[model samples]
Target: MNFRRFKIGYRTLKTAVGASIAMLIAMFLNLDYYSSAFILTVLCIQPTKRKSVRAVYSRIIASIIGVGFAFVFFEGISYHPLVFGLILILFIPTLVSLKFQDGFVSSVVILLHLFDSKELTWSLLWNEAQLMAVGFGVALLVNIYMPSIEKDLKSFRLEIESLYSKIFHEIAFYLRNGDSDWDGKELVEASEVIEKGKALAYQDVENHLNRRQNLYYLYFDMREQQFEIIERVLPKITALPVNISHCYIVADFMEELADHVHSGNTANKFISKLDEVKEEFAKMPLPKDHENFLAMAALYQFIEEMDQYLHIKRSFVGFNMKKKTASKES
Candidate 1:
């Protein structure tokens, strides 16, 4: 058996522990329908702390509202089957209107308890409230310490940068030699890495209640934008009709850019070097034939795209600062 494939994730472990604790506490309190606490804990456990907190809050509020509806319909009117069905019709909408739909299942559980007991006594209400507190409270407590995904985020960042480096190097090689055996696998790999990185970064953002933005997320987003530009210009670079002096110039710049593909903010210097290349290209004589003219145009468009790519990196504020902070932390 491949036990490695069955490796439990942190969130799963937390959910299990939380559910166990919630059930034990509910049982200790002698709450009726104590097993429901286990279900509540499982339902309330979320991947991110903010989500878990929100889930708990919603479930608590929804349970309270459920109790209220039960009191009005069952106690004031009658605990008949028609009244039960009617209460559900109105209860669901009320929870939805209050934005507590996440708690619908847990609230329904409470309603079932009331229906089973066939009573709206004060003791039963207190028992249900205690169950909610134990279940959701345990879930909230368990989720308070979300394991940091910083290491995974950093690994993805490094993988993306390495892939980008290889891609740029391949482009430079093709531009210089007018032929490359490169299979362009790095392009696809980089795309996948960027997508995964963005997802992980977004999860990190959700992990923190107060954090509005994650720097790693912004970094991946910037890289995604740059990757699009790279994809756009790749065919243009490869399909140049003739290898000219300007192509070599751009190739050399690309090699230099490849070497500097770290999490640093050095795009400004490259942009300056690129401008020099542009000036050099301008001084060359006009292309002598249509093929050469098309080649020159393609090279020019490639340079413009490279400029956009560098500008995207430059516009990513605080990237270098975050890099430094990460370095110090390491």
Candidate 2:
């Protein structure tokens, strides 16, 4: 395996701490099933505390199901290999159909332990309950404080905006010069960056239980939309039949737009600038030949893309940016 990519995170520390604490407490209390506490702790810890929170309920429910099935199998039927098979046949399908499949493996292990008990009794069922409480309780307390993703989210934002600026600068250079050294590798980088950013942004949102809004997600969403337009628009830029003098007007506009990609504010200025370009296009002579026709069509499409891109930025202006409200103020 690639241990080179492995780095211990806060979540790992949390899980370890929680499991150790649960085990210690169980040992002190001298519970009949002390191992269950540690087992529960290991199962409950999630990469994100929110995930732990969500999974806890399922773990509890699945434990109940497993214990319940074990009780029925031990008492209703004989404790034979065939009975265990019958229990699985009923248990697996029922859990799946209920959409509680996440607990299936854990529940199976739990049932196996109960199956090997010295005697089937109410105390056995009570022991399982104690394990569940210890495990789920430790997980809940440990996950109360989630680590912040603000720093990482900021890095993604800066990188995304920087990439946008580079792409726009390249596009303008290509439009005017009809050539560029850049191969659009940044599109691939941007895709990975944005996908990761959106996921982290979502985790950031999940960390805050009461806050429903997600600014970073919206920010990435806007960039993702712009990314789509840019991929479509970039290739056509080099093919325009116009020279530098003809492309100069749009070139200057693009460079100016590039400067403001990270502004994250109202886009009135951008909208007005695009309107001016559209007006200029309106007065220009219509394309008669195929080459000019394609160039003109590309120009029109580029304008529309820019307009939509600017609007997406505008949509998140007053909302959260990087998990904080007052993005416009920023």
Candidate 3:
């Protein structure tokens, strides 16, 4: 037993050391010596992995253009003076702001710096190109290996369910208590939290294409819908309160919807029930007071939208009866 324990501890230590070394190697690869890296870093902070690809590609293209321009302009200038520096300082930012940022644009500026020194040549441009290509390659490799957006779909389901539950409880609070004076801050807070969850979910889907590549595109598309829900209801979150028990009931169904998604147990009947709740919430009486009614209505609509979004998200997981049956039958 003592020998076995020693062996296990050695293996564990070896594995831990190996993992730490691998992580350090990854970080080293991501570091850069070029000014272009700064700009590329900015462009690369996309919410999705797909956008990372686009940003890197853009930077590569830009670098070539900028470098080529530098080469051409350097050959033409006779004297390196304050004039050359001043001219490019004003020109590059204009190009970046007006058009997409390109690394070649910066290369061109670098070329200008070399122009006055009269040391630039085709070889110099070639070296710069090599440097940029390496930087881009490093970025791509780092992102592919360790995407910041990766999350297990199952965990995302749990997070989203928790958010939906919170929203439901907030709605229930208003409905059961009929607190007209109760500001809708809780609902707003829930919306804010859901928005964060949506963003995180979308990002996770994007970064780990291997995990849920089929839903990657849908994740981005659905975020827009979720944001729309937030926007429509956010302004009402702080408004005068009204009786929204009915809305809370609908919100409860939305929480149930997330459960259905997780359990992979939602049937046509559940869907119909959801639809019924949605309809009831939609048709429920509103306050005669325009402000209170409108706020309540906004909250109701927001929950309805969430229900619709959840439905769409579930479709990817095949939560519908038709798909679930097919899955089960298979």
Candidate 4:
């Protein structure tokens, strides 16, 4: 296998091995009560450096809440199976909706099992909490020693870059060859990738919510805005009566523009292409009627705005800043 592919496989193996070792150690200590909680809390959490810590916090909090509820109920009622069943009905759904509900549920069950005993008291709660701490500590080891956030983010960025390249290629083909069929397919495919990209990017943000400098959130939000702008342009571009050659040329320009943006660089090629497209519009023979002129004018307007969006992207990381300048112009 290639180097990158081998690294991915190696990482997966390392994670599996680490988690297995953790499981065995927990089991040997008879800490099965917290085994599920540890895995679920850590697994559902995004694989970020921060989440390793937050997962511990969330698990601990949820455990306390669950055990607290169990203790209250058990103290109030005797250990009747029917009462336990009823409590289950009420508590299960409530726990499931919680952010770290999986861990909480396990904790509540442990509490219920130990309920109504004379041994039940703050001391027992402390003991359970300590065991949970051990489990959480184990999970943290896996996260720290076998972290994959850097690898995950790099992979995600590569996928986005690849998709951007394909989108530009499709656009170019349509513009240069006037191949409506291929351009249509390309646009559809690119849209699908954009949807997928948005989902992945959002996941990246959620994984890092507890971190201090969450640049992933900013990057994801920026991509979302760009997705919106492109969506608006796709239909307009498709509807234009121009031949495949014009479409491909425009697409080629867009591809180059997208590359510049992806690299976080200025879109000089995009600006030049915008002017070229404008000249094309101006030189085209007109129907000499008001509505036709209006339609042509609208097309130019869209292109100009799209160009402005690209320019704004070149200047900063978000639409919020661009809005200020647009307001100033008005």
Candidate 5:
């Protein structure tokens, strides 16, 4: 069995290895305060690559600023309670103004070193820089070996498609038989699955430098929008008193649509197909009976919902295509 499928595998193991390596490197170099390297590595490991990069950027800057401020404050002013308070007042505002607040906690750690050492010397400052470099650098290198997310992305896509297929099939069955076995729980499951899938896709984006838009993210978003319409469609399906002629028509259409959920069919083609259905229905006589009228009304509402779902799906495709074309041209 693939052990990495568990939560405590590759990522956590890599983090531990990275921290150990950082400390080893620091010891080999004979740097003072070598444990700082291990500490920094632990703090730097993040859920997404983008977050790790941001953390490193802000912390490095914050550490440098911290060292400089502490050196000046300790040497130029008396190291009294009032002086420390004054330094914090100035330093906190400076970090906020520079938009480096993400590093505030790290900066405090940097300040603590100055407080304990009481030696404002170049040698001590160099040690701080060395630890930050070795720690963050090792962490970055280890994180770069991220496993291929393509497989996971495809898995999520298939899951979402399956959910959509089930929903459509259920709708078709309901229209055809005037009864449905579907518990409507797939709607909830689909929402949860899409949201989780989107989060993973975002992490994939963070792993790449040149990634503009993740197709899986777009795919999940399209599914999520359609999910809302599906919610509306189900109620209308259940509200009709009895099956009408249009109900059979819609049942057949939904069944056909379910077969093509993962077919990569163009949204425009579906839109065109819907136009034909609308036109064909327009040529028929209006419903004469109260039961037929109710069923026809529900069928019309269902068609509108399906049309909206298709359009939303189309919007993602069209927008992403234009983006890719522009990227290629540039």
Candidate 6:
């Protein structure tokens, strides 16, 4: 059985439960057009808490404006087809201007209720308001306890770190041996991991209303910037016409870096070591031929790129410190 394909997601389960509860409550209260509550519940349910709350507020305001328009168009003029169409034309633009376009469908539902009645009364208005309250209220309650994606975010972090480590190791191997049979799969995999991590991190940000920034999101952003440097250096490293004595030193440094791939800020130490490498390169004998000269130039550029990569990591030191301080205070 391919039950995996048929598996219901949390959002789906929430929508069904919330809609049912809303409809039941409306029916219990003997509200007119009780089924409309189900529609609102289904519409109001959103993937994140902030979105759900925003949907509720938008719908409530739009529905109120819709009722006002209904009163003016239906009662003030007449309950006719032309008047209904006129209300839609004016109402849609008004909602769009107010940035309540998300609530258009809910407002239309309210308009239809008035259209069907042929007349607006206090009792009917109260019934629709209660329906909105029941439906949107149930949606809000169901969405209050969103399942945390912390575990998924953590998994992505570990995967990105692992891919980065593999990439660094491969670069080191190429530098040391002057050639490799490597298919460059790690570069592609690391890019994909960082992208996926960023998406999940952004989703995590959307799930929390109070969160102005997510540490995981910032971490993925930093990695993405670092990955771009890695991509630029890979070709430069591989295209070297000849490997100099300095290549082995750089390879050793890369190997140490690969082994220490972690979430901590240790890039300053590597930056110091890189400065020492640069001094050693300056002291070494000049390239003997144009080919060796080109190779040394490429290696120098590679070193510059590596410096930029480490600097990117180093920049996160202040960010992490602030995050730690906030954590302790909280």
Per-residue lDDT for 158 in model 5?
A: 82
How do these models rank on TM-score, best leading? 6, 1, 2, 5, 4, 3
Candidates by lDDT, descending order: 1, 6, 5, 2, 4, 3
**What digit string (tens of lDDT, one per residue) describes model 2 on residues 11-95?**
8888889998998887887777687788788887876656777778787787788777877886678778789899999988888
Q: Can you write out model 6's per-residue Cα lDDT over 1-330, one digit (the tens) per residue?
A: 454556889999999999999999999999999999999999999998888999999999999999999999899999999999999999999999999999999989999999999989998999999999999999999998988888988888788878888888988999989889989888888888888888888877878899977888888888889889988999999899887888898898888888877755377778888899899999999999999999899989998998998888776633346555321100
Model 2: lDDT equals: 0.78
Model 5 residue 252 CA deviation (Å) reads 0.5
Worst 10 residues of 2 by lDDT: 321-330
Candidates in order, TM-scores: namely: 0.92, 0.90, 0.52, 0.63, 0.87, 0.92
Candidate 4 lDDT score relative to the true structure: 0.55
lDDT of 4 at 289: 64
User: Where is model 3 poorest over a 10-residue stretch in terms of lDDT?
Assistant: 321-330
lDDT of each: 0.88, 0.78, 0.51, 0.55, 0.81, 0.88
Which digits, one per residue and each the tens of the lDDT, describe model 4 over residues 1-330? 555543555435545655566556656766535454345433523355465676667666766666655656666775666766766676666666776664554455455546544346666665575556555665666555433355555455455556655655555555456454653454455455546555654545444545433344444445456657766765565555544233444565666655654543445556667888878866768746665555465466567767766665554443235444321100
lDDT per residue as tens, model 1, 205-323: 99999999999998898889998998999999889988887888899999998888885536778889889999999999999999999999999999999988888877776444645
Winner on TM-score (1 vs 4) = 1
TM-score of 5: 0.87
* TM-score between model 3 and native: 0.52
Candidate 6 off by > 4 Å: 1-4, 317-330
* Predictions: Cα RMSD each: 3.1, 2.9, 10.7, 7.0, 4.6, 3.3
Candidate 3, overall lDDT? 0.51
